[model samples]
Target: MNKILSILAVGMVGACSAVSAADIIGTVTYKGAAPAEKTITPILDDPTCGASYNGKAPTTHFYAVGANGEFGDVIVSLKDTTGSTGASAAPAVMDQKACLYTPTILTVQTGQKLIVKNSDPVLHNVHLNPTVAENEKANEASINAAQMPNGADLNYSFVKPEKFLKFQCDVHPWMFAWVTIVDSPYYSQTGADGKFVIKNVPPGKYTIVANHRKAGEKTQDIEVKDASVTINFTFEPK
Candidate 1:
């Protein structure tokens, strides 16, 4: 009789433990509105512009996912999800191709090396410029490294957290890309559907930072304790 009681007690504890092990997850969608399209002023505006805002005109955002302007990249929610297996994350890849970064959205851990790959037929000098706006040589680091060609990777690391680094090919000035280096492992780049997830987080409270670049960032307070929780975000372009 005592043996039977002990067995049942163990079974109940095992069931409770199993239930507590599930991770939190959910999708982030725009709340009431979508981001507004961002525009820029040209140096010398043509009379064709027919607008009055200084030399500023709506920029011709080339890529379907304009990495240069508002609604540019996805804002990943970091703290909204939590569990045990989230710490000690691995570094992600950020490649340069056709004169631009392959993934418009990039997530990286502090001290993580950024692997800059080049696949241009011509020689390209990878220069890292620090800034929030575009300018000529904004404290750029002209790598003395070999002029990469074909498909070679150049490994670089930032000593400090920069605002945002602009990568350019000195040989091909038109080929420009950007990457935002953050200090945590929870960063994520949202997809076209505007959804993201961070799994296996330990029980705790966190501030989920949603960076949309031109539209800025949206932060939310989240607490992860018992089971998985749900959280979302949205930004209207300004």
Candidate 2:
């Protein structure tokens, strides 16, 4: 009996240790000379496109912001999450302020959640298209503005293997958002100032991806073991 108890205790310790306590953090920025400021088009889905909105859903795209020819609202993620748990970090934000999707590129992991906050008083619909208008990977992931009268927060979990996901406000029709679900917890989004930090990572071989959303994405492999890893990546206009 004592032997069995000892074995169980060790098992529990092993399981606890496997918990990926590491963190990945970073910022998204433009390459080369930042382009002339130009307003992006709203990402609303056209009714004539025959997509399903059900009258209570949002399916439009927000105006897109592009610099260095790379548009905001792009997503990047790890292809495999087999032995990995979802990321451990504050939910990356996709704020709708001034009718624009802030930080068009967002990083997320499997089993993680996204909090949608309405910073503006105007009514807006939060619509999502995982595969976008052309691929149509799936349909109808929505948070209607009318449903949340005041400020609102919504958490979304990604359970499948997808390359990318897109979001928009049907009401405003000019609001747009993007998300990438990585299999591993080791990922980060570049901030406006163009910096990122990944923390507590287990020492091993890993890859880092720079998310440009519409401008496309770039990836780099890294080796780490004991302490934190610091790496920087830049993408030329695509």
Per-residue error for 3 in candidate 2, Å, reads 44
lDDT of each: 0.54, 0.54
User: After superposing candidate 2, which stretches have Cα over 4 Å from the reference?
Assistant: 1-31, 40-93, 132-148, 161-164
lDDT of 2: 0.54
Assess candidate 1 and give its TM-score to the true structure.
0.63
Which 10 residues in a row give candidate 1 its minimum summed lDDT?
A: 61-70
Model 2 agreement with the true structure over 117-182: per-residue lDDT tens digits: 767655667777765332233223443334243466655666554555777777655556667666
Candidate 1 lDDT (Cα, 0 to 1): 0.54
lDDT of 2 at 204: 62
Candidate 2 — number of clashing residue pairs? 27
